[model samples]
Target chain A: MNHFIIKNRKDVQKLSTLAIFAGKTMLSNGAETYRVEDTINRICSSKENIKEVDSFVTQSGFFLTLEYEGEIFTYLKRVKDVGINLNKINLVNDFSRQFVNQDISLEKGMKTLDEINNIPGYPKYLKILGGSYVSGFFSLMYGGSPQDFLPSFIASFISLIILDKLSKFNLTFFIDRFIGAFLSSLLAIFAVKLGIGVNLDKIIIGSIMYLVPGVSITNSIRDTMSGDSLSGLSKGIEAILSALAIAFGVGIVLNLKSKGWI
Target chain B: MSVLLQFMYSFFATIGFAIYFGAPVNSIIPSGISGGASWSLYYIMFSILNDKILATFMGAFLVGTLGEALAIKYKKPATVFITPGIVPLVPGAGMYYTMSYLVGRNFNKAINAGTEVFFMAAAIAMGIIVSTIFTRTIRRFKRQN
Candidate 1:
């Protein structure tokens, strides 16, 4: 006996939308493509409402098919503005778990998803302060002397501010990172030239950690190891590109300095 | 000791990064600890073995392991912790040096630095893969038991 629950088209739409909402949250918040696909599968595997879900996830969007009561429904969600917001990922993961356990109603679920999706990130002030700490301490660890600490910290703080301001204008991610990195290295070089720091290399490296693709590279490795080859490759490429952009930004500034153009 | 101090600094740096990464409030401290431990492990391993890549691999492995354990304990995904944990081993310095040399038209140094960065990235990937496989097998064993 085939015992899949009968769901109306309206119900299918709601549930699929909810699943897509969860998926968009995951993708936007830096969840690997495989994790996003698994979560979608779990959400759609409700014995009561749906029988199966086939989902295809990429770096930018997702396509999902929901099969229920001998009917098929498909959804395509375009994911824009990808950035790391782990809090959103955790929230979506929690909501998905609750949903899979049949602990939340459809309307309630929709409401919660919207709320989590719109949750405010940490304040800019705090972000700049954190950047300061990263630059100041990482420089010391990277072999910079105490004199370089203040320069690195100041440079990184300014870079974070520039990043925040530029991103607000809805600029592309590459440009945002490129310009953020350019300002960071420029500041570091200027500080070193003016006797603010002895080690330009260490200071520049320290400040650029804020722009490094550390998290992305780690996720790419995890995704690849877990057999999500496409996701791994896409994320790996993204990491490389971002790393290259940072390098380019720094290189430009250093070249100008070397050529007495700065 | 200075190693301990380095650990604390790395710890503090990661906490800041965790916040910026928007880690959940409760997991923030644990992620920071994970990041710091990974960095300090690399430092200690490098001091003993005098090899940057080996130290990075060991540190990355431990980071993956710790991240898995924390993910289980907190009922959250492992990426939450592991993403920020490997910051210290991501070869940011190597990438910068390579670019610097390349821009300055120093071909030999650029090649050396670029190759070093490439290898370091590979090692970090290897380390994460090893630990992820180990953890999956361990989890499966528990399930079988």
Candidate 2:
């Protein structure tokens, strides 16, 4: 184990930078705010001669301050494009534990963090298949007949492709979900009209399950219970707004169908 | 559908979501099991109790407890398991019905479905909180000894 010593201001700056980067990776990848804060503090305090470490993390950004050798260095990062990727969170959690226990050099730690950040998620085709399975099986679970399964799968598969395409344009998450939900319901209706599906409501429910804010809802409550009320409230609002967006999307299609417009 | 079929469907659905969310590959099956078991519990409870909110609470509680146990065993964070496990229980159907009611101009039905949706969400939150507290307390006691 290397004895990592903070010998100068430059080393201190490097240490703080590493901590902030790790925190950013976690936050943007949908880790809880409290976990982000804890990871940052643990990383900063693990090295030698660090006098103080404080980190404040919210849904949008984070601020970290570290004191070493009579110098206080602070880092503020505004995180964007928050998405859910549980593998990254797990990797970072492991990295922090390893970092705190072993004397890993600051530069080495930075390199490892970079590697972790660059790791790609599952391939597109598999993710598409995964999305289809989610919707198809969910319809069956929700009491949809076996005939509805293929329709739910087809609707969600195409809409997930649309969602993936729309995300490339860097649209806000709300619009992406709105369009996704709208397309899925429309497709579900068409499937029924074509006699490919027997139950429109079941198909619609299953297809739209892809857009529900399950992660945000769970994280919001977990954050609040852990005393990070700010993060909790923000995530709760996010969940509500996404739910509403999905509702509006599906509601419009259902309304059109009711009026025989479709 | 039989309980066995519901469990099987939820298992595959949970695995699909676990992959979509990029959970670690080794942890996927464990999460699937937890998701399947909890959804089956929810199905049985809803049938017997006929209370959506209480049934949801029970389902969420099972997910949380099982997730925590799996996290400890796999040496990964709990969120990896809990996030995917809870998806089947989220009130997606209620939200859809609520919107349809509003669009059909059935204000009373809309309000009724909307309130139940809100309460179901809260019930899920409460269930998770209680399970977390339960685990933490048990850990504390073990450490004290």
Candidate 3:
């Protein structure tokens, strides 16, 4: 086994660093933990001298081990602010597949990996427009009158801006969702109070739809069914926590209304 | 007319969601189609049969199937499309109702709404799983052949 270990210390160091980069990209971009682990394994296995690789990832961080030349190296990486960006996930997936398929040099691979990690996230205007579109259409689909469309769009747009601004504070996701949903509900209620919207409830619901963690919930289900139990459970908890946050925000408003406090 | 309205809204909504999630630009339309088709299927099945569970199940299955095909064609994973594509079917209204009723201290209504959300979510998940198995099996068979 040692005879086949042609990779020297420098090569092993490069491999470990490359693996860490890929792992960070995947974990930070909200890839399933098992997928992160799988990608790391694939990237490392591309090197002939890499003997064994094992990785464990959660929503928070990862512990990875690599063995080569009869020596084992371990690394721990912290993951934070895991947001969903499918484009990054796809590019990294493609890169990892390319890495495993052939003789891409370590330097070239690192450059590609850096590019994948640095690809710009969604544009600012796009986030606001996307938020408006989702809320507006969702309101209509949920049986809101045509009168509610513009109000829903406006409410969601404002909340999106607020949400983006709050994100810069590096607050936890719960606070982000809570504040965003609260603002959405408040504005929607104001629209209704002005006699412009027919269904206050529908508008509120539609606007707060932006706060729902649909992606996390859907991915958790897929992850669980795919047999990655811990990853599934962690993502499931994330989705549930976000849901609770949204409900908290909306509940404060509705509870006030029910009590004639507002 | 109502069905068409629902379809169009879901289509654009899914596209918007895809953008927000930063999905690949070229696959956005396909994801939109998946969302539109899922809503249309659910509407048809629901109108004809008055069955929410079966309707959502079939709808999610169609969305998953479409996502799986689009994933293969686009060289991306099925999840990229599926997550955004199924946004239209996530029982948003049910969740809202549950929250409102709970807030209002209407326990019975809250329970009703909550159960509906639970069932709908489960149906959607089951549908996706079933369709994933279908696609995986077909791909495996195709490779073997």
Candidate 4:
């Protein structure tokens, strides 16, 4: 049976060290799932006689579920030669350097979020619109079907326009969400009616990705896995709440449309 | 010629991501080259198998293994260099789009796109986890001797 399993605590520690290091890299680079998956693959392939591998990345981190179909002793000898150490992982360093950066004053934080909301003129809105348009174009170029691209483009454009015309106020977490989802639904309907052959799935999903909270969720999970439970919890909650906000925004717009309100 | 261009795109795209993510420009070349080679493998597998999931893992494995070799030589975290190389292949934004669309409306289209994203994620995750476990377990059994 060829598999990568840690029979003792030392091996577990070694793997953890690599995971912590890899988690840091994943967190910094927008915390995309692919990076996290790639890191796990890198770690597993580091050893010798690794035949037949499988792995999974959850919010928790990478867990290697492998099957070893190679000679045992030679593989152990190679593993010993790798010079991996559990103590060198610097759990504290990883947390402090990456996860601890979020301690900001409420005043400053709110102000920044406010600025993002309150910026006058349509240029910023158009910029977002333009980003969506290009993103759709790139998405199509990269193999998205026309059914996916056309509707998403219209939805993005309309949503941005609606967002632009809406009154800029001091944004609250909840209110921002309401506006976002409301506009998304409107854009979606417009796209649907325009006969652009839009797929509702494509437009809504593409629009939301611009602000999806992937990095935070990945980081929170990484922190918790590395033993920074408190920070991880906070970050996790933040990520989840933000996701909920987007969901709420999208939901409201959807519900409104069902009610024929807009 | 087009395949060659796609390889270059994957290669350059990986390098650009590496720099953007804080890797030095000096190391970017080797990293990109490795990533490009891996993507070439991916292109081959995807073309042959016509399975994006299989292609993703195989390409990812190649990139990761080659990246580990590079890390041993360079003494930096394999992730710093390897991640950028594989990222272009990961479907992050794609999955999110699928999900949001499902939530909004269009059940049929949403299900189609969403399933693709879900399977891709699952496939990638399974590949990484299984590979790691396989390596670790083999070593443990070897140690008993």
Candidate achieving the largest TM-score: 2
Candidate 4 per-residue C-alpha lDDT over A197-230 given as tens digits, one digit per residue, 9 for 90 to 100: 4555445655554334333443454445445565
Best-matching candidate per DockQ: 2
Docking class of 1: medium
i-RMS of candidate 4: 9.5
Tens-digit lDDT string for candidate 2 (A1-262):
3478878889888988888989999999999999999999998888768877899999999999888878788888999989889999999999999888887888899999999999999998898889889999999999999999999999999999888877888988788889999999999999998999998889999999978787898899889989999999999999989998999999999999889999
Model 3 Cα lDDT, one tens digit per residue, B1-145: 9899999988988888988888888888989989999998998898999988889999999998998898889899788889888888887788878988887779999999898888988898899989989999999999999
lDDT of 1 by residue, B1-145 (tens): 9888888888988887787787889998998899889999999999999988899899999999999999999999999999878887788888888988888889999998898888888888988899899999999999999
Clashing pairs in 1: none
Candidate 4: segments with Cα more than 4 A from true spot: A1-141, A144-262, B96-104, B130-145
- Residue A202 error, candidate 2, Å: 0.3
Deviation (Å) of B21 in candidate 3:
0.9
Docking class of 2: high
User: Candidate 1 on A30-128: residue-level lDDT in tens?
Assistant: 998888988888777764667667999987899999787788888889998888888888888888887777557677889999999888988879877
**What are the runs in model 1 whose C-alpha is more than 4 Å off?**
A1-7
* TM (chain A), candidate 2: 0.97
Candidate 2 local Cα displacement, residue A129, angstroms: 1.4
Decoy 3 TM-score against native: 0.95
The weakest ten consecutive residues by lDDT in model 1 chain A span A1-10
TM-score of 2: 0.98
For model 3, residues A153-224, the per-residue Cα lDDT tens digits are: 999999898778778788888899889888898899888888878898789878987777877877788788
DockQ of 1: 0.75
Per-model TM values vs. the true structure: 0.95, 0.98, 0.95, 0.43
Task: Let me know the TM-score candidate 4 reaches against the reference structure.
Answer: 0.43
